[model samples]
Target: MCLLLRLWPVLSLLLLAACDQNQVFEKNADFDSYTWTVQEKPAFEFEIQDTTQRYNISFNVRNASMYGYYNLYVKHQLFGPDGKPISALLHQMILMDPQTGEPRGKGTGDIYDHQFVALRNQQFRQPGTYKIVLEQYMRQDQLPGIMAVGVRVAKAENK
Candidate 1:
């Protein structure tokens, strides 16, 4: 009973550290075949319960070391709850260092994870469903070495 009591505080800290306090929505699409085709656009839909508060939107890219390009180009299209297009934009995310050619993400061996902030301090403006579609903008029809793609929406933190 003494040992159990001593470990309780450590165990509680671990559990609390694993929890995401500000995350509102997060989802991932895994590619079993490890390929992301241009036609296979992944769409992420999230609900906005409080439109008054601002949020930070981010994109998560998980790729293997075999990914050829040093950077990834993606096109994002956002739609409102009424199914109308809100905005569209293209973003370039650096995956590897240009000079050193070293991967620039958190990875154990070959697979690396990269998170790019797509939107910051942005208000949803509507308390309903919002959709975002992601498409690869590379010239190649199919992109390989991409294990998964994800979206994360979190409540903005005060500066």
Candidate 2:
């Protein structure tokens, strides 16, 4: 009975953590970007309050550029329940819009390729849950095609 009593605390903690790991993603196909747009369907979204570590976020796209080249322009934002943006996923590589100096590209794809990116070395500072906002930051603005996305949520090492 003593062993069972001691194990209960650990088991309960594990259960709680497992529940917290379950993310709720909302697909929003609405953004104010002129050059970038989501499909007529829904966008893949992951809502997690995980701040203690990094999570793998991803999605797919179609008919990106006029050259038939494809890429993913993804934007991530962590918001509170009140819908105020908390944190953002800012890229250092820097993608530029044709008319703007502000780096506007999200994720770039290999030549004529369809695959996944790990977004390695991604983590959050806190442990609270968050809503991960993802959308096509850019694509072939002249024509219409499609882009798909995939995201894998994992715990960071220290967390």
Candidate 3:
């Protein structure tokens, strides 16, 4: 029982690290300006290997607790291998509950982290280079309280 207790923390850390190692591609863009403007579209480029394999795609956003709104809207654009536009989508993400005003995601001090799934069980039509661009769609000319934005693509686990 003592041995199990001593090694439990180490074993748990290893298990958590192992779980996160399945990411096919991940990229994060930090906004040094501390503001996300409509013109300041952040782009992430990644290559696809196997078109047949399905993957889960999500957006990670970090914002301060003082973020004035309970939700955020973003415009997403995807470009294909030939540099042609593939799809354009408007995504609405809820950051906090409207009724309670309670925040979502892991928080430390004033900042919170949120992961919104943009695509699930999605497969690329072709194996090639792809580009994803994101822009804030809020009414403000320069949105505040946004710290960083990221994209994580992981291979789907067999069900």
List model 2 lDDT by residue over 47-146, tens digit each: 4465555555433222233322223445656555555675666332222344543323332331111223335445655444545555444544432333
Comparison by lDDT, 1 against 3, better one: 1
lDDT digits (tens) for residues 28-125 of candidate 3:
68787677777888999988988988988888887777788999998889898889998889999999998998888665566677888897887889
Ranking by lDDT: 1, 3, 2
| Candidate number with greatest lDDT | 1
Off by over 4 Å in 3: 1-18
lDDT of 2: 0.40
Q: How good is model 1 by TM-score?
A: 0.87
For residue 5, what is the lDDT in candidate 1? 52
Runs of candidate 2 with Cα error greater than 4 angstroms are 1-54, 60-67, 89-129, 139-147
Give one digit per residue, the lDDT tens place, for model 1 in 4-39.
Answer: 653453354346435978888877788878899888
RMSD (Å) of each candidate, 1 decimal: 7.2, 14.9, 6.7
Range of the 10 consecutive residues with the lowest summed lDDT in candidate 2: 106-115
lDDT-better candidate, 1 vs 2? 1
Model 1 error, position 133 (Å): 0.5
- Whichever of 2 and 3 has more lDDT, that candidate is 3
How close is every model to the real structure, measured as TM-score? 0.87, 0.39, 0.85
